[model samples]
Target chain A: MKKFLGAELFFESLYDLGIRTIFGLPGGYVLKIYDVMPSYSKKINHVLTRHEQAATHMADGFSRASGLPGIILCTSGPAATNTITGITTAYSDSVPVLVFTGQVPTPFLGSDAFQEADHIGITRSCTKHNTLVRKTVDLPKAIAEALFISNTGKKGPVLVDMPKDVLISESEYKMPKEVKIKSYSPKVPLKNSEYESFRKVLTASKRPLLIFGKGACSDFNKKLISKFLNKSKLPAMSSIMSLGLIDGTNKFNFGVVGEGGSAVSEDLINKADLIVSVGCDLIKIVPESNLKSKDIVVVNIDKANFNARTKGNMNIHTDSDNFIEKLSAEKGLSFEWEADNLQKLREKYLNSQEKEAKTNKRAGIFKLISNLSPKNSVFCSDFSYEDVILQKFLSVSDFKDSILSGGNGTPGYGFPAAIGATFARPKSKVISISSGINFQFNMQELIVTLEQKIDLTIVVLNEKKNKQKKYSGPDYKSLGESFGVKSHQLSYNDKNFENNFKKFFNHKGTALIEILI
Target chain B: MRHIISILVDNEPGVLARIAGLFTARGFNIESLCVAETEKPSLSRLTLVTSGDEWIIDQIVKRFENMINVIKVEDLSGEDSLERELIIARISTNQKTRSEVLRVADIFRANVVDVGPKSYALELTGNKEKLEAFIEILRPLGLKEISRTGLISLKREKKKITER
Candidate 1:
């Protein structure tokens, strides 16, 4: 054990857990932690953001892109309150994030001291778990427990509220070998009887549809899921969060199937005899009326995701990979779907999309971006009409290739998430697509691109005129220039529009291309 | 249906609020609640009474099990369980009405804990129906005030199994 201050212990604990980066802005209660940040700078990289909300989103984006828990640190009161939206976003999407907020001294707690807030009380419902560190000795254990809780089970945001006095005090700290929380165990072992029942259900159904959600994205065995679907010859659909899990071009895969999804997939939801939803929450996506008549077999470890809102046929209490592996091993399991019918639906969907691209300029812009950007590019969009258009056109081949504020549908999620995604996937191109009003949510973050010299492309579809009567937004060209980044403006009918966009796309550094229609 | 949900949780601050907040947020009502330290000093047992349909009760149970501090949750609704509540009632009695109050207290097997010239404070422990009956019978005897501890329940186990 080593005697170290609470601030040092906090950094050391995170370093031991393989956390190399954090995003946040320091303030009054958190200044002491920042003062000692340089000592650990060689080991841990800290990204200073303009706002606490952006810092939270950056961490969330990092997690969604890399499958690593995003970590954020900030001060108490308003700073802590600011992270709530970002925290709720991660919570709704089942993305793991660790949020550390500095609080007032223990003596001043509940006295309405300056810069003090009840962080735990405010974040209780939103977080997977949250705690306030009252004593210096418990700081290390609290961080370990918070990390364990956030990264395991349903995987959402966890907060650790650190009182200022605790940060100033010193304690003999030892790294915990393992964290054991008796109350939480995400694993539900599959029984042989369960497999038998699942096989029976599969054998009885003729046209079974497979639906994927964010819960299935963590399997990392993307090929296994693909192979199972191909061998079984079952049609499949994806939720907004699981946009890229199944290849969009696959004959059996009918793109996304929710409010932001395609029309063909929604119609298919009504046609299927049975739904084998793997790691997806059907209650949020499918209407209760549609789900009532159909047989649903939900495969998810969390009991909370089961169909409490409607009647469910069966629940396989296990992870997607476990259930998929078992199902793939079954013999003589075949689906009775007509290939001709599926082909007709696929062709009709593609035809409608092509017609949309020809008619709608916004749809055309998305088509252009999808056609021009590298196949491995990561696209992040704010929750807006522009995101819906992007989702319809973008064919994602990689897991989480298309990111959005899916569960919470937060407006200003695109730009900051793009910044975080850039850091997470440095080898791949990262693009942030947003409309005029949505981009203004976190527009101040434009300086981050210039400051970090990040390689990212900002695509703004200028549709502010639609909301001009409500509010007038700033000029994107001037905003980009003031941030010292290359900026370009183009209209849909401009001469050599594609060529201008191509030049900006391959600009070799941070740049903005505002497309006006 | 009324459900007696007994929860075993780590004895820590803010834990009670976390468990209760789930019900409040979901628009579920808690009829009564009792909390005390368990035999294991590190844990606390909270017995809560609530009424809802089967589906709603199942959802509530799953949510309670999901909390980080909750070690275990059991719905004692269908189990062989014993429930009890303690109540203290104070009644004003004059010289003419003292015998009537004493007779009512005797019939309910209540112990007189405090006595004054014009008042008698009686304490009784029983199930919901018994307690309610005793209160109803004492109301006409110049009942002054009443305080009750919420229901606390435990499941029954075979005595031989533990002895072995």
Candidate 2:
């Protein structure tokens, strides 16, 4: 067996796991991983993000878009701290992302060494699984487990914190064929009895409603979902995280249900006789009062948090995709409370909502986005204000195509995720929309786009009144111009603003369009 | 209600601190905590006692299992479990109390660890009720110094313990 630097073995392990890309910023104690990057550069494309936090968003974006584990690397201390929100966001949404952070040497670990951090301590609560490797031989095992645990039963973020000495030390490398944890059994396969129990409720649900949530977005079962929806002919709505589960054009598919949910979606949730929430945590979307209706069924991939989230009549512990697949096979009882009435209500309400959005300057961005978006476009957004527009107006064909911070609700998800989306689908158009303050969260990512020459368009909704005051009175145009991206600023009220907005939207290459409402 | 929850985690460095930090972050205090290596060489069992309402305890237990290092969490509150704490207490000795202290220790089955010039160090391990009873008896003897190992618990093997 040839001797190998632990870092070499670690990167090789990532390559073995089929991670073709890594997003990270280099810092102290993490220099070893960067030093070895050149050796694996051919096999892996490392996108160097400016802030360590954005590295996580980039990885999160990559994972959400590609359905593959996004690998993020950063040094210890502040670098690792930046991963908290991103990792938490991924954890909340159950996105598969593997994070690797450097640590000070073992001797200095507790002595408050320079650039030292208790990465495991900080991220344990936010990650699905995490470990700090003490030995070089364990590096390969740790990396394998990190990826395995991340992409396993309930997909989420995992971290492997490597001490500096462990990376520099020599080790004999042998890639493990399989990684297994005796304690971890992520899958609790559905029993026939359990599935049958849920099936009956779903079938007997007269005036039934279907709710799609984040769990549905992780791995969309397109055939299964559409078949289930069609057979039921139930008026379907999705949580904000699952905006693109069904296209807005689909009759059965109503708009999102959540914080920025439309008035119509709220009405549907309230009036439904039986709510069959598929893979959605009812707490995130349904108002607390409406969570417990006459009948509610919560079907989730992980049933661990369900009992706490709901006093539901039934909880099924099976993969959401599997449950939907099984549901499609069953000849579901016809729920005919009149699909026509709901469809008519949906059309009237959806149209009215759009008309209402068109009347206001701040909310008008939704109408503008809907009008300006061409075919084959995906939008990533951040925070409260912009989330409303992106969740409402952005036309999404697939849930995977729509990216936002659903669970973590962290800001600055837009830009980096757009960068990752560009990489995920190079042929399609990717847009990042956020309010000015939230947009500035990862404004440093401007360098990532410039260096990678990625095709992405960034649109900032500059709320006219800067309530936060931090993002006020700055020329966002100048900031983008400094980064060499085509920067343009226009007011929502400016004459011919619509024409310029469309032109900018249709323009090729990296660009930032700041809209001052 | 006060709940005793035990967590099984990977036996690695800083893991204890991580577990401690989680309590701090959530603004939950660990009333009594005892950690020891389990049967598995790479895993350790941590038993913590804390008091809270049903909802808070439920959330705390859920959060514990969600920790990356945590393998399992068992809230041993209402279960058929055995909880014990070790206490080493020093009693100021006198002609009258010296005999009384040993007589009390004898009844409690506690071992006399050391006999000082003016005090006796007695070691005891028992359930909360038993320990409290013994402490009450020793209170009149005067407590010089006391050290305690916080509660450590295990589910009394249900297969055998309940089968009989």
Candidate 3:
């Protein structure tokens, strides 16, 4: 008979799943698991984060970069609660993360046991799925299921709450050979009627616009999207989260569309007769209010968004790539009207090329990024006017990777996520386009990047004052003060910040570059 | 249009709540709903009859499909399918109603699975219409209380796979 502790089994399963790192803080309830962590240190790296919130963010960053489910572990009670924000962040962003938390012993559960919190109940809303291990025998299966849930379909975070007693309990555990969740099958093949209807709609429409959302940016479907964009010559704009899905240089590209959208891109979206939203939520930011046009077609993996938003239009529920492929295969489609509009857009928006004009730090930073970015570099940007400025100055080639925060516009997300991206694709150069103030939120994360020897570059826009206040005046400063920023205290001089950053990173075995204008 | 949709979901807590919330948040009307565990312990099947327009139904299906626990969804309105049968027996009989009930049971092909000195039980399996018709007759003949296994379905001939 083979006997093994449940914590060992859980870690073994994680190791088998190719998990290389775990971000977490230790606690009394999870001490046993932490004790066994050293035995597997050679195989897995544990990141001791200052806060559980940061741990979850670290995991999220890892997931965004690697496309693998990010793993996180923490103790019970407040420790577990701290991870809620991170889990919610991952959930909203559709990042795959597996979160593990300790619990008081099952016997002591619901009795106000020390460090006991309703981990499952609290995290249920934030996670795609959650499970509590009641039996020691269920440990392996539960962990496996958590991983499966985190990685499958519209991937998001999943939580497994392990009771301390269950962790210490001995049982003959056999990992489930397969998972058969009958009620939850996510595969939906397009119906024949749906296909015909979509084909007819596509053929009849004179002016068609493609709006790619984050779901279309999956690694599995990039080629299909590229092929479709190449063939259709339809002007397309990605959601902020879907930034790099379509190459900026593509003839049909209209750039990102929203509040921070380019003037030309917004103009094209407003003029589109038939708007095709692929895997986008059709939310307020990408406002339907602006789309008074009735002829909108939404193609999405989620039927609810499509159906809800399909009042005066056609809604197609299918995988983004599959729908694009099906559309590409249809015969007798002429887009003469679309071609005319594309040319008009090109003449209006594409004609302005100002590489020689460097008037401000925003423009300078943008030019620097465009000039120095390697063929396959990944750019992560903070939510600043710099994003808009960079859009104007930098022309992303077909090969570079661009990751944006999208719906979850959390500040300080860029630097850590960039670090995770570097870890995910070590061969690719990873850079963060940071706003000066947003950098203050997760400054501690830079220590992790340095310690891990991750190759990531942080390009901070060193504006001595809040430009929004400087330009928009006292009103903006009032709002900034209300939001907890002391506008008066915001100032910086040219003080060899690059070398200082390099020295800080040098101790941790990483590289840093700071550009001051 | 009110369409009958069958959904397969993981047998976990809060899944039903999430599904219901999704529908309610959209202000869609769910006329009737039935959910229960199937042969598989870890999976549950939900049958919902909803009245909405084409766009609304499409949205409901699309949103439901996006949920991680939802394995599959089927709209049976346009298919050849077999609906499930639920039977309940309420008898008030010492000897007189017993024979009458037995004669009726024999005629309707229902089985008397339970029996007591004053009461007897009969099990019937059929479509909702047939079951309702039988219940109407039983009601007048002193039917007691009834239990029903809502609606379960399988395609009549071949399995039709619908894609998203």
The most accurate candidate by TM-score is 1
True contacts kept of each: 0.61, 0.36, 0.71
Residues A1-517, candidate 1, lDDT per residue (tens digit)?
6689999999999999989889999999888899899999998989989999999999998888888999999999999999999999999988899999999999999998998888999999999889999988899899999999999878899999999999989998876788987767766667789889878888998888989887888545477767776777788887778877887767887877776567687778888889988889877877778777788999887877776666757988886777777776766677778889988888888888788788878778878888888887888888765566566687778876788897788998988999998888888889998888889889889988877778999998876466565325667888899888899888767889988888778868888998876
Question: Model 2 off-target regions past 4 Å?
Answer: A218-220, A308-312, A466-472, B160-164
lDDT of each: 0.85, 0.80, 0.71
Steric clash pairs (candidate 2): none
Ten-residue stretch with the least lDDT total in model 1 chain A: A463-472
DockQ each: 0.51, 0.36, 0.34
Taking every candidate in turn, the Cα RMSD to the unseen true structure, in Å, is 2.5, 3.0, 7.4
What digit string (tens of lDDT, one per residue) describes model 1 on residues B1-164?
99999888889998999988988887989999999988878889999999987887888788887888888888988888889999999999999989998898899999999999989999999999999999999988898999999899888873111100
Tens digit per residue, CA lDDT, model 2, A1-517? 8999988987888888787888888888878888998988999999988887888998898888878888898999999998898899899889999999999998887788888877877786788878889999988888888888899877899989899999999989977777777667667677789888877776766677778887766444765677666776778888877777776777788777765675677777777777878778776555777766557777876645565645656877677777777776776367666867887888876787777677766567756775677666777888565565446666677777778887677878878888987877788788888878888888989988989998888988777564674447568999899989899998887999888888888877899999987
Candidate 3, A1-517: lDDT as tens digits: 6876777877787787678888888999888888788898998888777678778777887787667888889999999998887788888878899899999998898898888898877776678888888887888888887787778767789999999987787777587778655445545567779878867777777777778777777665566666666776767777766666777767777766676654476676667677788788765546667677647788776655654553577777777767766766655556855567577776666544343224455665566565666677777765555464455455554322665455556677677667666666788777777665666566666556645666666665545455544422123233334433222222123455334433432222343443333
lDDT per residue as tens, model 3, B1-164 = 75778888878777888788767777887766789887777878888777777766776676676676777878887778877767878777766667888888888889998988878788999977888888887876779988886666766778853322
Task: State which candidate has the highest DockQ.
Answer: 1
Docking quality band of candidate 2, CAPRI definitions: acceptable
Worst 10 residues of 2 chain A by lDDT: A303-312
Worst 10 residues of 3 chain A by lDDT: A483-492
